[model samples]
Target: MNRKQIAVVTGAHSGLGKEFVKLLTEDGTISEIWAIARNKEKLDQLISEFGNRVRVFSLDLSDRTSFSVIEKLFLEERIHITYLINNAGFAKFCSYDDITVDESLNMIDLNVSAVVALGLICIPYMKKGSHIINIASQASFFPLPYQNIYSSTKAFVSNYTRALNVELKNKGITAIAVCPGWMKTGLFDRGTIGADRATNNFSGMVTPDVVAAKALSDAKKGKDISIYGLPVKLTWLFSKVTPPKLMMRIWLMQQGIKP
Candidate 1:
């Protein structure tokens, strides 16, 4: 029996993840796409929209136990994993004092831990030409004041994915860190609760579709990082030349936050 060529995407129910799923389904090389998210209803809806090509896995990536569940399936199905998109993450727009410790930790768990865990579990099933695209943010470029924990988590993701790509080169596997600007997704709905000044400025926000398209193109080119939009690209360049303290100060001022 031949192993199926499948793509595994976390947070695949909607937003950027959903766009990725839609693109993957059209990929002639991909036999199936495993859509993983916390919402079963939304996952089921994906199957309806994309047909049997989309496999639903309603698992919360933040929970460590979820890795075990995914691992078990990998063992049983013996699928050839072509792509792993670690896109399941959240952000909160508020001061550090306003965020509970649990919220901060959960952000770490889902954004950082989930990416690491999924990479370890899926790498064995992947071969050359396989891609791992982790959705980071332009926020990763700086230490945000009000969006503190979220920025920190994305920074870890951006750096970690780049380093991981370096390590995976021996196997010809490509890892891409997608750093896009503000996206008008469901993320903002939860992120803006008791929103502070940071939420006021959503500059150069793009839709998930644009980000997803560029990510796929960059992955094919074997680029280590995919940054969509000219504004976001400029931000990445700006962060590199500027000092960390200065960058933080700039960000705080841009958001009208008091440092």
Candidate 2:
């Protein structure tokens, strides 16, 4: 039996996740797109917009049980996932002292844990030419001051995706970490609260569509990490040469905060 080609995208209700869904819908090879998100209303909206081509799963990835639910569905349906986009994550722009313990752990649960879980659950269903796109951030490059937890989580994503790509090459599976600079997304709306001073300067911000397009292009080329925009690429290069301490200081300076 020919398996139905599907694309699974978490955080598909909005922002980069939605953009990924949009692009995947355009791909002729994909038979269906699985849109996973927390908002039932928004997911329903996506169904209305994209019609039957898109299927929405209203599940919060941060909750560990959601992984089991996804795995069960995959087993029952026996579907082939062509593109697995792990894009459900959030950030808080505050000092360690300001953020509650629950918030810090939630960030890790969604950003780091969800990425790993989804990859494991979906990999068995993926065949050759399958692409796994993890939405990492340019913040992964350095030790950010106020955005400490978020940056660290993204750093883990970047490293994990690269290493996973190397391991999955024999299986003809590609994992690409998209490290885009500040993008026009809902992340800022939640992250910028309570830290207005530190979040004021958003340099080299671009739209989610731009990053989504570049990520797909890079994935086609089988690149390990897909970085959008020249400014972000340049920053990635700079991060390699600069010391960690210095990079932290520079990030603080850029945000108009004292080191």
Tens digits of per-residue lDDT, candidate 2, 78-193, equal 58989999999999888887878998999999999999999999999998899999989999999888888999999999999999999999999999999999899999898877
Best by lDDT: 1
On a 0 to 100 scale, what is the lDDT of residue 239 in model 2? 94
Task: Please write out the lDDT profile of model 1 over residues 1-259, one tens digit for every residue.
Answer: 9999999999999999999999998999999999999999999999999999999989987789999999999998859999999999999898777878888899999999999999999999999999999999998998887888899999999999999999999999999999999897999888887755655688888899999999999999999999998888999999899998999888877877777
87: Cα error in model 1, Å: 0.2
Stretches off by above 4 angstroms in model 2 are none
Alpha carbon deviation, residue 157, candidate 1 (Å): 0.7
**TM per model?**
0.97, 0.98
Worst 10 residues of 2 by lDDT: 192-201
Q: Which residue runs does candidate 1 get wrong by more than 4 Å?
A: none
lDDT of each: 0.92, 0.91
Candidate 2, lDDT over the whole model: 0.91
Q: What is the lDDT of residue 50 in candidate 1?
A: 94
170: Cα error in model 1, Å: 1.2
